[model samples]
Target: MSVDKRKTIFDKLLGSDIKAELLIFFHRNPSFSGSLNDLASKINKPIEEVEKAVEDFVKLGLLNEVKHYYFDPEADKELQNLVLEDLTKEESKSTFELIKDVEKTNIEVLDKLLPDGFPPSGLILILSDPAAGKDILSIQILCTKIAVGRKGLFITLDKFPDEIRDFMLEFGFNSSVFEKENKLVFIDCYSPQVGIKSKEKYSEDPLNFPNLSILISRVLKELNSPIVVFDSLSTLLQKGGVRSSLEFLRSLTGKIKESKALCFVTLNRRAFHPAILAASEEIVDGVIEMKVEETEGKVENYIRVFKMMRRRHSSSWLPYIIDVEKGLLPKT
Candidate 1:
């Protein structure tokens, strides 16, 4: 007779096919705690193997042994009740409250880029090639919101908060005033990478999607009608794999929609996989594509609206100039 060796879901979780099967059996028959000989017979395994697996589970804190019977201590009533409470709790807001009027939310540079103003509550993707002014444009858009008395949250994955602050100051926008007034907040996702402790709401591990989601949620809950800027999505795509990055974006967008806040996420067009880029574009409300052109001896920057959902937008690419004194200015 040949023994079966098919992998099960528990096998993946426990890293041992036989142990996973035993765990499943125990879970199914929660009250059936038995001796090693009985468990070995029930699972059709050697008594020694059964004993080893049981001892492993006990060491891992998944099971407990009392008077020669192994059982799952996590199946206790108090823990079960806590899990049920989490599963049954109602969300703070409904779907209808998430969607907002796109016409009323006005972003300064965005208004000039799109025929209509910024959307009220959705993700906006900004794509550009390297050195194409994507970061500068995104910062200018954020500063525009801050200048208009709207709260802004900048999640910087590629640059330190001080670097971003210096850039803003060099471009003639004083970020200190906004920081002092508590209108601008920065979630520093880069400082920890270089052995430096972050002073802001720091994410020690940027690749941890659940941690990042929780941090963003807590911040958004405290603010009202804010503009959230993800400095660059490409960094996240590199840190986390494609699937995890996509899942993170989906969850973040859902939260942004729920809060009725505008989200601006930038991506380096050339750094991402084609499939990942397509997947990201599908989730956003609008897309702004930017590029640089060498004309004669000078480099010129241009931008255009690639797509805007539920709004009339210009598809024509227009030339733009970055002025240190005035920020981004549309060339006449």
Candidate 2:
């Protein structure tokens, strides 16, 4: 039986430097066959340890062992390319001079909006009017982060996990692959309150602020530099009241910052009072606002950076349109 390549590679390939060296050697010398002792001496590792690792790889169909072990050229070919590509990228990075410490969200418009890209541990709030596509934009940002080899935690307050997954698939993002690799997680706060049993591993009542915070903290601890997206904060404000929601935001942002992660929270600008919106904005590191206007029976969407702490951004509302394949795009 062939072992799951994605699972094995994600879990074990980076388990140790020894495993990496072994895999690299096998990939580079696909046709090479050697005994356990020979392979151990080649990589300068102990025969006992190498033999165990080699057997594990053989079981995973990465290697074929008849008289001696050799790389299985046809085994998980796609994953093999991904592994090699990732390893090559690491090697290339080692040769280059580091430019900035911030992680790129991989969104083109952001390059113009945030000149420095997204700073680690920054909490960004997305405020939009009804049907302005804030939820779609947030998910796109999350998917973008995941595409760039970062993990993401999406806390769904207004939608089902399945709906989110379907949306991801519609945009050509494979949510299943991300979930299987443990790179994308969904906290189904919507399901429990809707009286539908959640299929997610992490879930809590949306109204239970304390339990929700604990659940989020536990998941955040397991991820590294993850991108977190709160579908919409309006649900929190409605369910927990303005004061409790503000307190939760402060606590959650602090936890996210401590983890050195990035979080994007969504909110409906018209859902609460102006004073409440001002208070909410105070808790965030930056704010991006979106709105739609109908003129002469034609409707258009626009987005702008309302406030970005310590960063220069274009406050001018730029026109935008949603594409079926691309979640959101700057109007050309």
- Best by the TM-score measure: 2
Candidate 1, 1-332: lDDT as tens digits: 01121112122224444564565466556677677788888878888877777776666455567766666545433333433233223111112223354453344455676645776678889989788778877887788778878898889888889999998898778888888777888888888767788888545457877888988888887778689899778877665655567678888889999988889999987664332455576567778888888889898888887766655566678888777666667777
**For model 2, what is the alpha-carbon lDDT of residue 57?**
73
Off by over 4 Å in 2: 1-104
Candidate 1: how large is its RMSD? Answer: 16.2
Model 1, position 3: C-alpha lDDT score: 13
lDDT for each residue of candidate 2 in 1-332, tens digit (9 for 90 to 100)? 12264335544443444555576566557677888878999988988878777766776777788888777667747554565455334333333224356555577666667665665667999999999888789988988878978899999999999999998898889899989989999999999878998888988997788888888888998987799999778888766655667789999889888888899999988665343555567578778989999999999999988766655566678888978788778888
Candidate 1 off by > 4 Å: 1-110, 295-298
Residue 329, candidate 1: Cα error in Å is 2.1
lDDT of each: 0.70, 0.77
